[model samples]
Target: MHLPSRRPLLTGTAVTALLLSLSACGGGAAADAKTGEYKLVQNGVITAATQSEQPPFAITDSAGRPTGFAVELMNEAAERLDLKVQYKTTTLQGILAGLSAGQYDIGVAGVGATAERKKSVAFTTPFYWGFTDVLTLKDGKQDALPDFDGKRVGAVSGSVQEDFVHREMGGANLVKFKDQTALITQLLSGGVEAAVLGGASADAYVAKEPVRIAVKLASLQGSAFPMRKNGDPRLLKDIDHQIDEMIDDGTYIRLYKKYFHDPIASDLIKERPKLAEQVMNHPDLAPSRR
Candidate 1:
């Protein structure tokens, strides 16, 4: 499928202000869910910026509305708060920069909470967490992370996997693409030995394509929502609180299974107790109602 080029909406000083504005609060008066009032980018709508392409997480439906796990999850949460979500599509890199500029009140697109990303925006507690995986054609020569050493490996530019490639897979020939589809195409065409990406996305793709996960890399990252730093404290709190309710009521797991087409395995949950507990709603971790 054809996709628009990843380009900045604005450059120079304007770009810096949006990203840095998080350090200082900038918005209308505080929002009150009870009264149905919000300090939104536009009144009566939450301008959500997201990647135009990430599958099973963020995508434009046939009707032109954004519909996917992360997008719908946010949509449901917004419904509970009585606010409408107006999605604006952009590339992964553009979403964060635009969010920083206050162009979008929320940003979602399979974003993981990495230290580097936190500098640009604040993350909600992870709604989903899993290992990164190396994906290659089933008949490809690469079989594991070690096998790709000094060989070409594809990752979306600025994605967490790209950082992992530099930090853990040193000496690897890194090939960056604007989107996952392109990265996987390179891997299939033998342009790269393998592509490093979220295990879930890799698994989903391989289910329909002639590819397989070569290695489930040890590095684990948690995907979450990104809001401008110091942007809207009340909005942030409400979102976190809403997420807690969703987990408590099993809504999050339902969404996870619907999109990923499988439950987060029991053994995997055991390995990441904290993340599991958050999504599972252990009695001790349940949040109080407002």
Candidate 2:
């Protein structure tokens, strides 16, 4: 999951000032008086923020439009709601901060639904779940988590991988990059001995780069859409409902197959038993036998 950066606690006034500064480029939406639903930033538009380079989840296509699993899911959800989306690309930090400041209606760049994040923003039902991977040069000797201790490791700034490095590899020299692209680049360039990434993202990079996954960690908390807390409960409910509908109707699985060839993560199915039934009833969707 793309986790938020560790930041110093802000004073009440400082937080308000920061939100004001961060929101200068956009206007906040007001709630609909009659329905108590959150109004769109624009009359019929959902202002969304996503990462430009978190591939397989969020990426800019050749034509420069936001198009990836997460983005497409949100786009479909918006369409079902009869709304259009205007996307802005930014770092994961920007996505979270923007949501908090009311600068964006939704954030969809593979964000993890972590407890710490729930304090300031709301998350829809998680749509995806997977593991974390440690990536190293094809010839690098590091083959396990402990092997990387005291070595230089890279992770996207404000990402869960960053948190992992801090918590698990306490003695490692942690190098933080602005995004996955930079982290992978630094790994390949020998700027860092290894890099940590989301499982699917690591697979995407390993397919095209000269890196290999040396370690695959346990499943991470699921990825979900983040919205400003206390902004609009109705909107949150609507999105969660749409996600459930998609999962039930197989729209979610169809999109999942489009980007990922691996079997559905077992933990995901465990959390959503209905999805497990779907896989069981359809052999084609079943996980490969080990």
Candidate 3:
């Protein structure tokens, strides 16, 4: 969770130059008068960006195609909008910048919405809530977050947990990795005493490794798709509408079970009631349920 730098808005000369380059390559943003939707980079294709290897969230399968919770959710939204999606993988740190530069139409890499993040890109209503957790090798020297004080701790270079490490555990030596797997590997190998990760990423590692959650950090608001600020209205609306539909029709819960191998509960919504209510207004998740 590194605090993002001030990002230049996705307008003016930079956007114009990027669009011109895309048009020369046979693709560019063009608004369709009839449907009121922006033509994507590739005709009929929504250019999506994601970080590779973030487990149950976004990962490349054996076929070298993106397949995971986030990717599948993006696919579902595109399907509802009658658009095809082509995924491009990059380091986690690059996803938002790419979107801001107009290099991607949408980004779905389990991005959590934060005030810092909102400056770089527009976030859709959150589709899933995530918790931040600390991980260490089972029976290792570290048993709690405090154990890492003034010691090395690993975090995905640009993730929210990395920001947590910096702000809350300022005395700890921060070691940043390009991906969560690498961060976990460092912790397992004793390169670091503990690592901070999203709860799901920690779960994925603990399933096969000798690791245990040291503690759960404060939960995040939720994960959402990141788009260029002031991007296509129809595209944003379609994605948001699809998310609302998923919650009402139970597709969101099904996807949660499929990826988490467990059930989705209203507890997630309860954890951040006001934020969730404002962003995700599905009737199925009423305040009474919380």
Each model's C-alpha lDDT? Answer: 0.70, 0.77, 0.70
Question: Model 1, range 1-290, lDDT digits (tens) per residue?
Answer: 11121222334354334323421332233344452566778887888898766777887788887888899889888888888888888877888888788888888778978888999898876776555787878886655456777898899998898887988688789999998878878887889988888867877788888988777643355788888785776777787667656754678767776887433432233322333444334323221111
lDDT of 2 by residue, 42-124 (tens): 66678899999997999999998999999989998887776788999999999999998889888987998888899989998
Prediction-by-prediction clash tally: 4, 0, 4
**Inter-residue clash pairs, candidate 2:** none
**Where does candidate 1 have its weakest 10-residue lDDT segment?**
1-10
Which pairs of residues collide in candidate 3? 1-159, 1-160, 1-162, 1-163
Candidate 1 lDDT (Cα, whole model)?
A: 0.70
Write model 3 residue lDDT over 1-290, tens digit each, in one string. Answer: 22121223343444334334432442232233233457466667789998778988899888889989999888887786778898899977788888888888888778878789898898887766656778877886555566678889889887888898988788899999988768877787889888888878788888989988877654546778888785675777777766556644567656766887432323344332222322233333322211
Is candidate 1 or 2 superior in lDDT? 2
**What TM-score would every model get versus the actual structure?**
0.78, 0.84, 0.78
Task: Supply the global lDDT for candidate 2.
Answer: 0.77
Strongest candidate by TM-score: 2
Q: List where candidate 2 sits over 4 angstroms from the true fold.
A: 1-37, 284-290
Off by over 4 Å in 3: 1-36, 261-290
Sorted on lDDT, best first, the list reads 2, 1, 3
